[model samples]
Target: MRKMLDLLSLKLLRRIEIRYRLINSFLLVSMLPLVIAGIVAYRESSSASQEKVRIFAAELVKQVAQNMLQQIEKIESSSEELAMSERMQNALAGYYSKNPAERAAGHGEIIRLLLENYGSFEYVNQKYVLDRRHRIMDPQVFAQLGDGVARFAEDAPDMKGRPYWDVYSTAAGQNSVVMLRDILFKSNNRVAGTLFVGLRPLHFSRIFESVNLGYGSRMLVIDARDGHVIVSANAADGNAPESGLVVAVARNVAEGRDNFVSYRDGDNKQQLAAFAPVPHTNWMVVNITPLNALNTEVRSIRNKIIAIGVLCFILALVLSFIIARSISLPLKQLVGVMKATRTGNYLIRMDYEGRDEIAVLSQRFNEMASKVHQHNERLEELVAERTRELEQANHQLEALSATDSLTGIANRRRFDEALGGELRRAVRSQKPLALMMLDVDYFKNYNDRYGHLAGDDCLRAIARVLRTSSRRATDLAARYGGEEFAVIVAESDSANAMQLAENIRNAVAALQIAHEDSPFGCVTCSIGVTAVQVDEDMSTDTLLRLADVALYQAKALGRNRVALSDPAGATG
Candidate 1:
């Protein structure tokens, strides 16, 4: 410990001695003060720049959050007024007075009355209705919402008494916020049924988008129910939860706390973002600014500071050159010794033998050259060893990320990346990109019957069948999660994909994996097939969603058959 301390002290002292001996006497004294001033200027400039950025981001976030809050409040107020309209209360009073069809007709008239009275509630992008039975009566209502909203009536039994907040989606696939108000229609002052009026996403989006913000900044209304991002601008549109950032911001908004956050933009290298929550809705407004734009003023200041430092350094150098010859006579000799050592002549010695600091500096330089040569050799060995270890670790991480542990098939992450690349390429080449989403029929029952370990074996067998059936290099079979798997067959159409899926299904059947609890004779699989035509507007997210919707359809229509959605069909 003492030796190490002594070595550190000597090294610092050696640098100081070299500075004084080789530099001009006047400039050497001035260098310390100049360096101190430069440091102070750099620190102050950095602090001011950082503070400015923080303030700008915070102010921007606060403004956006406030705007969003106002917009949602407006929508909520509009919903309230529509719910309290006389037509709605009158319709609800007689809702149970007649059959479902009569109730629907009455509800439609009430909705029309509300729309005629309040123009704000009528929008092309929203669906408004009062749903009593499994049927919904609306002019613009989506056919898909018929089933989903029908189930909700059962979910909320007390919905007939008072106004309750119910959210739903439009048939056009946009999110809709519905306020269900109890309507008491009375020819003789008695309760009737219920009235449901909806506030559209576009209404909120228009209001949210009206707020002025910086470039590339966006306000998005997201549905926390299913992670469907309803209204967004200046971002890739999709429902996938890539990061928990939106969910976290949505939570903050729900809690009525306007907070600020930062994250990296995935699309660009230099982008940084700050996010804030919009109150009273599942909405988050993010302020995105490129680092280059944010730090432009700071960078200019840094460049100017560097330029000044260089000019001062040049002036110091000239002054040192003028007065250094006589005082640096020993340094000139020591420099010659260093030059000799540079040419592999370390045997050469400095001439100074005086009992001064320069003499000690010269002695230390001679010792330093020897130590540096030894360290160079050892450092090279250490660097090579570390490089090899890093490469190995990187390879391991890549493998673990791409390969599923249970079935040894490609994982969802790998499938997403690889299939996205292939889809882009196929689209460019004007070839079809085919996808088949497969799920083990009654795999949950299989797990219940045979145990989880046997379920693992069943999955392994199924994965092997899929891998074997997709023999082409362009075909990729990936484990989509749990008992679900997906195959991306590039340059193939719907017919070819269906054939490939059928082959895989048959191969799994041939494995004869017996399951007495299986509804389908033995362990079987259901398949959903979809194909994306080569087109300029085709997107990876949309294609995946279509395939997913088709998969759901396949499961819904009997469990052991194949189902396909129309290529241009809207995804749920």
Candidate 2:
């Protein structure tokens, strides 16, 4: 009985030890991989997302700030021009010059100046002058200044000081933007009157509207003198706060440390702010974006890792030892196969048993392999097709480039090339060559009367006549340029070339195209023929010029006529 009990206890202990060892091994094996994968995924995702967010934010801020700087420059230069205006200075001198009649006369001149050039000054809403006494001199003129125009007359206690821009709400129920200047005399350099121009803030906003930052980001121009938001897309939100961020950023910006800063919004959300100062104005621009919105992927990745960890723990407890071994062995094989994909062997695949994620992975690998094979096949086919297409395209391009668009004949460039070769050949073989030049008569008036379509038909008919009249295989026909054509005949004498020219002219005249403006009482062309000789130093340019001169003589003498030039003394 004692021996039997010892054997049974030993067997039970072995079973318990095996279960514990299996559980521990499987847990360590499965959980370690999951943990490593989670850590690597989180790190890679964070790095990529951060890089993308940084570039997007930096570019957005830089472009918006640069555009606002340009607008500030325009406004400053324009204000300088307005301050130096002769009519404006004379008007201010009249307003502050101690006589009511002079002031009235100055007012009339100022009104005429504003009215005469109102269209030119689209940005300036109204112009006004404050007298030395600081009293409201012309209420009618004030009415014309509109409710948005703010005037601090020279007589006020605050008016004893210097020139500055004042932005405030006016009694005229307008948001007034005003520039104040102490007008001076060029001779004595004394203060004349306060020259003020009132502009609406809305004018500045029109320029800002064209700049794009991002979908939810904004470019804000805030007054450094005050916390008022001047021009911004966020102004329409109605819930955006009057920013203390602007004041703090402007102070830092003035000290030359223009770096990005973080702040909280009215909704208590954290945001990133970047700003720059406009050089001549008491205004700074701010670009703002929500920080969380920018780095949203970080939170999403963390949540996913936690969820995966919980799932792995459940799976570790449920799977049996033998089953876990089976899964682990296949997984190791799959990892090796996946590694092969990085080396471009996309044909590698894993063997899997059950219809789970791993099985789906196996199926995906097979599909990917199939697609790669198909893509390789398709790539080869595409390369073949593209090669054939390129050859055909080359042929078509050669034809289109050498031939005329309207007349289906060789064009001037082709003619130049051909003439050079033929001249060389004629010099080598001691053969004669002839050139014929022809022009349309009354083509411009024919176009004006019957339209360009009829004019094109007439040119085409003339080209056809020249083509038919020249019957030799060595003859070449070409469109020289607009309303002009030429032919080169090899081994043809001057007598035969002149006869061919007459034949072309008669063929075109026989076409019966009407030209009421024709000096010959019919639609016709002028022809010039010149023969090239062997001993003569004949070149393409020289032959073309001689033929052109003969063509000119034909037109000058009378239309519907042919003229010929002897080229016996032609030179290179």
Q: How many clashes does each candidate structure show, in the order listed?
A: 4, 3
Instruction: Give the per-residue lDDT of model 1 (tens digit) for 364-451.
Output: 8878877877787798899999999999999997888788888998998799999879977986899888888899998878888898
- Evaluated against the true structure, the overall lDDT of model 1 is 0.66
- Each model's RMSD to truth, in Å? 18.7, 20.9
What ranges in model 1 sit over 4 Å off? 1-328, 331-361, 570-572
**Which lDDT tens digits does candidate 2 get at residues 1-572?**
64554443333323343446466656654556556776787777766754554556555656666675675556545555555688777876776566545766777776665556443666676566555543333444435343333334432234333445545556655555555666556667766655566676666666557665453566676676654666665447432344767656656667876456666776777776666655545666666766665555665776677567666565554434344544555567778888877876666766655544556777887788879877977998999999999999999978888888799888987888888888888888888888889888877777878887888888888888878876887788999877889999888888888888888888888888768877666679888888867544666888888898789889888767888875654556
In model 2, what are the clashing residue pairs, if there are any? Answer: 134-155, 537-571, 537-572
| Model 2 lDDT, residue 523, Cα | 78
Q: How many collisions between residues are there in candidate 1?
A: 4
